[model samples]
Target: MYKSTLALAVAVGVLAQQANAAGFVEDSKLSLSSRTMYFDNDNRDVKRDARGRNGDNRESGQGFKLDYISGFTEGVVGFGIDAQALWGIHLDGGKGHHPDNSSFIPSDTDGSAVSQWGRFGANAKARFSKTEAHFGSALAPNLPILVSNDGRLLPQTFEGGTIQSKEIDSLTLNAGQFTHAMGRASSNRTGLSVAGGTQDSNKFQFAGGDWKVSKDLTLQYYYSNLEDFYKQHFLGLVHVLPIADDQSFKTDLRYFDSSSDGKNGEAGYQFSNNGGYAKNTGEIDNKTWSAMFTYTLGGHAFLLGHQQIGDDGGFVWLNQGSVVDDNGRNEGAGGASFYLFTDSMINQFARAGENTTFGQYSYDFARLGVPGLKTSISYLRGDDIRNKSGDGSYNEWERDARIDYVIQEGTFKGLGTSLRHGVYRGSGEAGADMDQTRLIFNYTYSFM
Candidate 1:
C-alpha cells in the first residue's frame, strides 16, 4: 500500500501542470459533517471492577469529519485524490465509566478518557474509461465479502489497493489486497486479524463481482481470506417484483462457507470458535445461510427472515484489533458490520447450531405528509445454540426499536436525528441480558 501510494505521488509531479489544469480543481468537492451521540447500555449481570463498582455504562460524545475529493484529471490516465479527517471529543464519561468496550472515545495510558482524538488519511487514484484504481491508507469498501463499519462516531478504514472495473455493462468487478486497518477507536492503524487472536495478519486478499441479470434480479459472489486465520466464500441473490405502483415484493438470499487455513489450529495462532460448537476445537469450520422476504405498500413495510448456523461453528468475518497496544488487553478493535440483516444493534446470533427467526415492521410517515420521518421495530429469536460443551444448548432473543427524522425544508434542513433502543435476553451464560440505547444528531454541509 505504501509503495503504490508513493508511485502515484511521483506520477502527480510529472503531470502536475496538466493534472491541475485538467478537471481536477474544477470538479473537486469538500464536505464537513458533525454528529453528537448519547449512548447507554446496562448489563443485567455485570461483573465488578477492581473498585468493586458495577453500573450502566453511559457516555456522550461529539464527532466531526471533513472530506475532500478531487475529480480525475483530463486525458487517458487521469489522477485524483481523496482525503478524510476525523475528530472526536469526550463529553461525559466519568472516571469509572472507562472500559475496553467504550470505543467511541480515546483513553489515556491509565485507561481514562482522553479530552480529544483525531486521525487523517489520504488516498491517490487513477482512472481510465470505466476502470479506476485506488491506493492509499483509507479505503471504505462496501462489498458482499466486506463492509466498512460506520456504526460508531468514526468509521473503520483500511490501507491497501483496490481496482474496480465496469467495462462490461451490468457487471461490476472488484479486487483488493488490504494490509493494515485503522480501527474506529484509536488514531493509529494496525494489522488485520480475527476476533480472539492475539496476533495480527498483514495480508488479506479478496475478489468479487456483482452481475445484474435483469432489471429486478441480481447475483453476487465474493471470496475473502485472512492469511493464517480463515478463508470465506459468499453468495447472494436479490429479486424484486412490482406488485403495484406503490407496492412491491422483495426476496434476498445469502450464504457463507468458511474454514480454517494455514496456522489457524496451531498454538499461538489458534482461533477460538467464539463460544460456539466446533467439530474441531480451535479452528474455523462453519456454513451459514439466510433467506428474507419483504412486502412494501404505501407507508408500511414488513420483513420476515430465517437464518441457520451450521453445527460446526459460528459465522466469521474480519475483526482487526486495536492499534494502541496494551499487551493485547483490549479486544474487539472497533465497530464492524456483516452482510446479514441479523447483524443488529446488539447481538449477532452467529453461534454454532443456532437457528434464528426474525421479523420487522417499518413505517414511512411520508404518506402522512411527514416526508422525513420513519420508524421501525424488529424482533429476533435464536434457539438451539450449541454451547462449548456440545451437549448443552441455549437460546436468546432481542427486540429493537428505532426512529429517525430529518428536517426537510427549513432553516434546519439536512439536520437529522435518530433514536434507537434494544433489549436482549438469553437462557444461559452464553447470552448476557442487557438494554442499550443511542440518540444521535447529525448535520452536514457540502462545499463545492
Candidate 2:
C-alpha cells in the first residue's frame, strides 16, 4: 500500500508539472453513479447462529461512485491519472437480519450493519506507443486468471501495477502484480489468500495474452501464482460463426489446471477444497473444464453448457474469506468471483468430481417494440460431488431469473432498474437451500 501510494504521488507530481498540456485537461471526464438495492435471502433449511437467530438475511442500501479520468498528456510518453470515490449507506435491516459474516454489507463492532462507509482510490498511468502501464489501488482486472468482483454496493479493488501491450496487430499482452485487495463492502485493505485460509499472501503475479486468430476466432492463455498458496493456469478459446444477417452461433471453451504451492497445506494457509472432497485435506489440486454454446436469432438467444471438476479436488480461485481483523471480525473480504459459468447468484456449483449441466434463454424486448427491456432465466444442476468420507456423493441445483429495463429517453434517460431472484437446493455436503432476491436501481450522470 505504501509503495503504491508513493508511486501515485510521484505520478501526480509529474502530471501537475504538465497540467496545462494540450490533452491533459482538454480530454478529461467526470461521472457520478448511483445505485439503490434491496436484498433478501431466505434460508429454507434454517440453522441458528450463536445468537439463536435463523440464517436469513434482509437488507437495503444505497451506493454512490464518483470517478474522474484524465486523458494522457501530449508527448512521446503520455501520463494520466484516474481517481474514484465510493460511499455506501445502509438503509434497512437490523441486527437479527444481518449475518455476522455478511459479504454484501460491512458490519459494525456490535455485529450490526454499519450506518455508512466509504473509500478513495487513485491510479497513475503512462502510455507509450501501443503499451500502457498503471500503478494504483483501484486496479480491477478481468482476465482469465483473476477477476475482480462487483456484486455488492461497491467494487472489489486491488493495489497493484499492471501493464498491457497491443503492439502486435492481433494480439494483446497483459501482466500484473497485486499486493492487496479492498473488499466491495469494506473500507480497509487486506492481503490476498484462498478460501478457508486465515493467513494472507501479499504477492499475486499473473501474465497472459489473447490472440485474435481471425475475425471470428480468439484464443487465450494465462498463468498466475499466489505465494505460499497455489498456482493456476488457464486456457480459453472463443469462436463465433455467422449463420445469417441476424443469426449466429458462438462456442466458448475454458480449462484450468491448478496445484498447491509452498505451505499451501500448512496452518493458517490451508485451502478448504470448497467444502468438498480433497485428495489431501487443505491441499490444492484440481483440473476443471467447461464448454458453452450459444445460438442467437434476431432478438432471441439460447445458451447451454457443461462443466466437469477433477476428482482430486474442487476448483480454486483467489479468495480472502478467512482473513479477519485483529478483533477476529471479518474484514469484508468474503465475496469473490471466478471466471466460470457456474458463478450463479445463489451458489457456485463447483466441487470435487462434480458434473454440471446448465442452460439459459433470453429475449430482447426491442423486437416487441419495447426497446429498453430484457429478461433471462437460467438453471444449473450438478451431481456426483465427492464427499469427505470418500464413499458417497451429492447433488445440487439452482434456478435464476432476472429482468431489466432502462428509461431510453426523457428526464430519466439512462436510468436502469433490475430485479433478480434465485433459488438453490442441495443435499449432503452442498450449501444450504435458500431463495434470494435483489432489486436494484442505477443511474449515472456524466460531466465533460
Candidate 3:
C-alpha cells in the first residue's frame, strides 16, 4: 500500500507541475494534527448474541495526520494537487481488546499484533471556470447513494474520478463515478459492492445540486445510483426564523427515498415466505426522513429533533464508517455504528417502527468567566418499535452529556479538550442496556 500510494502521489505532482505551466499559479498549504484515544468495551453476555456485532476489547492508541493542498494556476484551465498522509502507532491495541476482530487493523495468519500502518493518497485536479475535475485515491467522496463508511479507527478512501460545477449563480452541481475502493485497512483496493452482497459493480455514479432561494432559506435535490445496488433521491430544506432579539430558531429537514437499480433492479432481489433461505435477491424500497430545530438565546442553546425510517427495509446510504481519532469523527468510511437519535451518545434507538425524539440544552460558560468552554446535556427516547418482523413493540432511552473547552487566545487558541458520557437502556428488540464514556484532547497547526 505504501509503495503504491507513493507512486501515485509522485505521478500527480509531476503531471500538475507540467500542466500549462505558463498560464497557471503555484501555491501550497499544509496542516497537521496529533491525537490520542482510549477505547473499552465491557458488554458481557451481549457481546456474543448481538447479531452482526463485532468484538469488544479495551485499548488505547495515538495517531498523526498531515493534509496538504495546492492552488491552481490562473487561466481558462488550471491544474493542482491535494494530498493526505496518515500514520498511527498502537499505544495499547492488543489481542484482548479487539479480540478476533480484524476491522481496526489487518490480522496475521496466526492472529497477533503488528506495529502500525500508514496511509496516503493524492488527487490530480483540473478546473475550467465554474467546473472542476479530480482523479485519484482519497476520502469517501460525498455522494448520496454510495456514501463512504467511517465506522472504525480510520476512514475509507476510494480510487476514482469526480467532476463538479457551479456555472449558475445560487446553484451548485456535482457528479462523481468511482471505480475502486481502498478499505480502511490493508491499503488494498477492492471492487465496490452493496452491503457485502454477491452482486459486484465497479462503478458508482451520483449527481446533485443545491440552491438558495432567499437569505434564510435553501433547497436541495440530488440523485444517486449505485450499479447493481440502489438508486436514491434526496430533498432537503434549511430555514431560519427570528423569534426575538438574540433568540432565533433554525430548522433542518431532510428526506431520502431509495430503491434497487440495474441488475439488482426494482423488485429484483426476492425470496420465499416462511423465513426461507435468504438470497441475494437484492432489496426493496426504503425511505427515511428527519427534522431538527435549534434555538439560541443569551449563552445557551436548545435543540430538538426527530427521525423515522419506513418499514419493508432498513435505512441505507453510503457510509464512510467511524474513527477513534481525536481530530473528530469522519463519516465517509463504511461502518454502520451510530448512537441513538440523541446527541453523540450513540445507542440503538432507531429500531424498526420506533419514532425517536431527542432534546438537548447547551450552555456556553465562557460568557460568564471562561472564554472557550461549553457544556451540553441531552436525552432521547424511542417508543412504538414494531420490530423487524413487524410483530411486537418496545421502548428505549438514552442520556448523554458532553463538556468541551478550547483555548481562546494566545498560542493555543485552537487547542481543544472534551469529555463525553452516555447511558442507554431499552426493552424488547432495542437490545441490551449499556454505558460508555470518551475523553479526547486535540490540537491542530496549519502551515501555508
lDDT, residue 356, candidate 2: 98
Q: Which stretches of candidate 3 lie over 4 Å from their true place?
A: 1-16, 19-26, 47-54, 102-108, 140-153, 183-186, 194-199, 263-282, 319-345, 348-351
- Of 2 and 3, the candidate ahead on lDDT is 2
- The number of the candidate with the highest TM-score is 2
lDDT tens digits, residue span 1-448, model 2 = 5667787899899999998998989999999999999989888888787887686789999999999999999999999999999999999985598886788888788888898999999999999999999999988899988889988888999998999999999999999899999999899988899988888898999999999999999999999999999999999999999999999999999999999999999999988888898999899999999999999999999999999999999899997748666667776778899999999998888789999999999999999999999999999999998887663469999999999999999999999999999999999668789999999999999988
User: Predictions ranked by lDDT, top down?
Assistant: 2, 1, 3
- For residues 34-84, could you state the per-residue lDDT of candidate 1 as single tens digits? 999988888888887886546556788898989988888888888888889
Which lDDT values do the candidates have, in the order given? 0.84, 0.91, 0.64
Error of 3 at 51 (Å): 19
TM-score of 3: 0.82
Which ranking of candidates, highest TM-score first?
Answer: 2, 1, 3
Question: Which portions of model 1 show Cα errors greater than 4 Å?
Answer: 1-16, 322-324, 327-332
**Each candidate: RMSD:** 1.8, 1.1, 5.9
